[model samples]
Target: MMRLWSIKRVLLAALMLALVQSAGAAKPAAAETLTIGLIPELNVFKQMERFRPLGAYLSRETGVEIRFTILSRYGNLVESFQRDGMDGAFFGSFTGALAIEQLGVVPLARPVNLDGESTYHGVIYARKDSGIRDFADMRDKKFAFVEKATTAGYVYPLAYLRENGVESLDNHFAEYFFAGSHDATIYAVLDGKADLGASKNSVFDWVRAADPRVDAEIEVLALSGNVPSNGLCVRPDLDPGIRERLKQVLLRLHESAEGRKVLERFNALRFIETSVADYAPVYAWAERAGIDLKHYDYENR
Candidate 1:
């Protein structure tokens, strides 16, 4: 009888402890992990290599475990942020605006380029032999854009065309194709498959360096006025203290020696503060282009 009682008592104790542990596990965590989502224009390995330094710097500075995440497409990044998997993101102006308007995110800062310019031009180019001289010449030519989500590719180019009285792809281009990324768009233009293409001037410069012949064959038919490039943003409900710290670290990145070195690695001049108000023109452009910026769905066409 005594032995049975002892075993029963031990079993009851174990069961009670397990119930208490389960209750404790149900509580929220003390510290939340910071998750960052990046674009996947380049190869996955190359993308990770480019942002690894920033990840390390963030970890060292904030004592937080910073993770570098990349989605197959910029659209996926925006979708994931909406689903609450991503805490912060670096996005093009269009996607950033969508994230803000769609997912309750907010623009935090933007990196100035090596020229100390926070903006870059959107260029529309055509093959040298295509006889496309300017925006008017793009009528009825087969065209390609970098990505639907890229401002340089879709937003700015479409806005420029609309402002110039070229309203829709069906009205202007013989057909339109999305090349999935700026690099791919350049390649399409260089191969003569696309009579016209739109992308950031910086991307064109990178392509020129890689292939001298592309520079010879490709000619810019039109260029949009300068606009801000990629922006770093955060979720709407991110803690104020953490948000302020991130902003401070980014804004001062070019001021300190270590931070400057990191910026050099990223080919950035410096970081500057910005707000949703800064992207007002982008929103207006979207409105003019008939894009419902708030209801952007990544999965569907």
Candidate 2:
């Protein structure tokens, strides 16, 4: 009777081992996925559509499904980042610097534009018919600005204005408000909603190409010095192999026809490696704007 009981136990153990082996055979490895956040540098829908192909491509190449989340505004990045539990984000210059300092994320890659330009500039612009060509002419005119956390949109433009002898935005302009995005800020001035506005040169060019009214009505007033373009950064604690694979995939995108298609949609020629050191220009502009990164530090609610 004891031998019979031992035989039954042995059979049960063997059956369990067979089931585990079959499961392993069915799936050699569990599929993995990553969720990367996208800053609203462009219209949210456009940003997602533009990046979907890249995400699909990366997923196919790396065996990791890639997902993206579009952040509505730039101001809440720090707290929102932790809240969303994203794997990483494609950060704009100012926010990228903040993330590096605060979240300890590592810079991975940035896109070089099809125009052979990797850096972008802050552009202050207005309607050509507005008769405001220079800084002094901007006095008492309604102003449109992108989020305060932006470099080309707010920081550099404010610094440029203050450096040019403007004491106060409220005192100088009829009124000013954050447009929530670079393209929206540009449109505010072009559509006569605001007299003057600031945006990144890249988005301005994009807007110009899509609308002839842009050139016929609007004119660029001032441009900030070159600042590093938006770059992808990831949590420092991310798996090293996945991190390296992502970087390599981005760097090599230009090598294939399908990859070229993705780059063309992005108006970029290729992706280049980046580092935390690339954010130095942001600090310079922030100082000129009299803004401190610490002041912008966000907390979890």
Candidate 3:
């Protein structure tokens, strides 16, 4: 009888081991990871740090890992996007319009800033004592630009200059160079480095609020029409379920306590859904600047 009991115990142990192995084999894998790029807009470090919390929050809420890659320059976004194997990006207004046209990326959502403003405009500014009062005064003056792939930094200045009877930057300005960022562009003019410069008003306001010299030493030359703020856009071929999941997560962020914390960090009131029509003004600006979005090349030159 004791011998039979030992045999029964051995059988039970073997059976339990098999059951555990079977359960392990049936367990599901962890969620997929998605890497997204942040367009070059503000100070790169600040921008990256600002979005880290949001990324973590989104990852937790969606059950998928979300990673942010900070772009250091406003280069050919689409080319760099794909080459770096990014799943999508938080595209700037101009880059968003380009991605929609070129890559068919779907616009997901955009933020309404703390001021309850969902849009921003370009400001052409000059140092108070630089004597650049109007378009004609820009002649022979050094200019600072954020980049060509930017609406506020390039399109507005181009359109504004052309409308004022200046056809090109080639011979009109004494010197011009891409300042790489709006913040840098503003400082370039403020520090007497550039006679004229352009930046999105939102950034200008943010910078001005921090520096006394911005209000004391800078004067506005022109303001572009309102353009949609930076927005989240996803790859056209992304998983439909994941895409919809992200959109819903952002669109409904205002209703949750955790989500509110994320919004507060961004200095945003809430996020709103986006549509193709939102980019019309951007295309119009590009057209006025004589740029065809479908074939325009700002990547190299």
Best lDDT goes to which candidate?
Answer: 3
Top TM-score model: 3
lDDT of each: 0.80, 0.87, 0.89
lDDT of predicted model 2: 0.87
How far is 233's C-alpha from truth in model 1 (Å)? 0.9
Model 1 residue 235 distance off true place after TM-score fit, in angstroms: 0.8
Report the lDDT of model 1 for residue 128. 95
Two-way lDDT contest, 1 vs 2, winner: 2
In the range 90-144, model 3's lDDT, one tens digit per residue, is 8889988988888888989999986788999999999889887887788999999
The sequence of per-residue lDDT tens digits that candidate 2 reaches over residues 1-301 is 9999999999999999999999889986668888898888888888988899999999999888999888878866655777787788889999988888778889999999867988999999988888898987998888898887789988898899889898788788888888888889888887899989999999999999998989899988888998889888998889999999999999999999999999988789999999888899999998898878866642211
Clashing pairs in 2: none
| Predicted structure 2: clash tally | 0
The residue-level lDDT of candidate 2 at 164 comes to 89
Show model 3 residue runs off by greater than 4 Å: 1-27
Error of 1 at 173 (Å): 2.6
CA displacement after TM-score superposition, residue 58 of candidate 1 (Å):
1.0
Q: On lDDT, who's better, 1 or 3?
A: 3
Model 3 weakest 10-residue run by lDDT: 72-81
